[model samples]
Target chain A: MPNINTLWRTYQNLIISAAILLFCAIGFITAVFPAVEKIQSLLSDTQQLTDDTKALTAKLTVLNALDESSLRQQLSAVISAVPTDKSLPTVFSTIEGLAAQSGVSVVSVDIEGDTALATASAAKQTPEEKMLGTRTIPFSATIEGTLDAIQHFIALAPQVRRLLRIRTFAITFPSDAKPVRISLEMDAFYQPSPTSLGKTGAAIVTLSDAEQSVISKVSQLPQVSGADMSLPPPLMGQMKPNPFAP
Target chain B: MSTSEINLLKRSGNTLRTLTDLEDKLRVIAWWSLVALLAAGIILGTAFFYLSSRSDQLQSQSAQLGRQIDAQLVKEGILTSLKQRADVAKNALDAARPWGNLFPILSMIALPTQLKSISIDESAHVRLTMILGSVDDAVTVVTNMIALSGQHTIRAPQLISFVIKADGTVQMGVSFIPTL
Candidate 1:
């Protein structure tokens, strides 16, 4: 450090040094750090806002073009078209009925659901939950029937819940049958599996404390003699966190 | 004795003359040392001035930078808060995209009254926690869930956990693996 005394025998140097130190102290607090943080925050906020605005604007534009109810129906149709449910049994029964009605014999049903794969599939299908891995439970059924029966069953497939998707389908037959003696190998997806009451008390897919307490409490409640399983999961997701709040 | 006395007399006379000259040389050297002192001081002062001038320039530049930084920070802070608000709104809107049919079924769980809360994470997993009004409720809820899951034809087993909370809240995590 250069001493003020060395520079001059005058008081001017002392005043100058004091003023400089004061300026530095003020600048240190008031100007330097805040400026850097502001610049960085500005850039980040810009990017973030841009993304948010894009999403908001997109929603707004959509809302402008279509009514909310119709838009929701459109959205549901798009979402439910994929195999989101794991309850392939319902679909199997539906197909079986169609096959039997058409005079076909029913055979073994097979299932293969890779939740990890479903999650990946959801990522491709939905944009928001890309990081939140999607889950899928897949099942396949092999029904042996006549060509006419298989064709009838396939024709009735459109009546299934929109979530059902035909992953794979094939046909085969025994030598004794006529030219169209057919065995149908159909792979279909159920919507997401229903929340279950298992040996374990868990129903929803969360470890959050709030959910667990509710689960524990509900386990004690008497089942309403009979409640349709299909109607519960969707309601469970929507109820105002409490129904039958004892 | 005679030889020693003679040598002492001769050496003593020469030693006095040499001492006189040496004192004179010492004075001369002492006189020149002042000039060296003055020169040393001048060199040190000049170096001090050069260093101080550089320091002043650097400090000025730093102050300027500090001012600039402060300005940027103000701009960034405003924008960041705005963006965060916008994001929350956007997420709320996104959530509206799902079908309402899925939520009601999940809610029919008939959770015990003692359970204080319900929350759902981004993965559609429901969390139910209760201050155990009674352990029976917990057990009943468990049984129903299992039965329902089977009936529902659930593919991936939902994850369920129960934590014995201090407040008697039996904490549970139910992984509802929704198809979508």
Candidate 2:
């Protein structure tokens, strides 16, 4: 029953107060809540990054303690003994030299092609061989020598620069005084360089004691001379004394 | 007084009473609203303070972690190279079948025996055929060869065949794999 003017006068302050509360609540929801969410997200990211950094630091500490130079030297020596390429001439020369040293006469050297030992060694290829990037090639050599000479040659075969393993041996003793003919079948291995894998950045490596021992043994193999490793100076590039002059 | 004038007076009094009551209710509502606004302000203020403090701490922690990450990255590089080099060396060593122990093993079995021929496969498995003067000599050789299994250099020595010839001579073939 109150007049409109009186009702308006009574509720004006209430309306103003309600409007202010609504504005404040809206401000809190729109501005403050979003900021809190952002801060929470940032904190979570920082915690995760901290954990990752700690793990990386621990790994780095272990890796930093190794003797890098000695490892490189050992690695170099091992790779040289089991070179990546066939280096057939070097292998041929090493076998011929061992034959001469053992006082044996070389009859023929037949370097077995890739297919010769493929059947034998292919089945025996280990998981480690696949991981290390290696393959095997077989070869054979025929020689005539005394029993002592043949024994010495066999003893020294594993010491050569290119890795060799005697697969089969056959001998014929025609007479006690005449030289015995010996047939030797062997396998040689080839490995692609580690760099060939195209891996970049650091990696974790763990070697067993047996693997370490093998590295040490291969490191002891004699270093192949540069002269023995390369083909004789190309005839066209050779420096020779002038035949027409002095 | 006339009846109409009395009714009009009563009606005005009732209207005044209703307005007063409405005014009291409005006062209560206003007080409650003020209290609610004050509580909301305090909550928002506390939230802002807490968020800002946490953000600052996180920023500092992030910076520290970033530095650690950078240092570790450099170390990781060196470690990676060393690991790769070591792996390459190990592979080469594995490929180079160094059977330096073969001779010693053969010498141990050399008792009045004639070693006809010996063969080794790519896996470093050895096969040997020999002739012994007697069954005792053959047994001695077999025992010596079997004893090589104790050495780290050999494994799985198996006597493949043993035949006694009419001339009282024993022929034997043995196969074994090396662990070098």
Candidate number with greatest lDDT: 2
Over A125-226, each residue of candidate 2 has an lDDT whose tens digit, in order, gives 566556655555567889888766777777778676666666667665452567777788876665533322112122344445765676677767664333
lDDT of 1 by residue, B15-76 (tens): 75775565555544444544444464465456455555545555554455444433333222
List, residue by residue over B102-173, the lDDT tens digit for candidate 2: 656777765313776666765677887888888988898887877777765468888899999999989898
lDDT of each: 0.41, 0.62
Task: Give the range of the ten consecutive residues with the poorest summed lDDT in model 2 chain A.
Answer: A230-239
Clash number by candidate, in order: 85, 3
Q: Where does candidate 2 clash, by residue pair?
A: A167-B120, A202-B80, A203-B80
Per-residue error for B85 in candidate 1, Å, reads 29
DockQ of each: 0.01, 0.17
Winner by TM-score: 2
Give per-model CA RMSD: 25.9, 10.8
Candidate 2 residue B59 C-alpha distance from true site, Å: 11
Which docking band does candidate 1 fall into? incorrect
Query: What is the DockQ score of candidate 1, to 2 decimals?
Result: 0.01
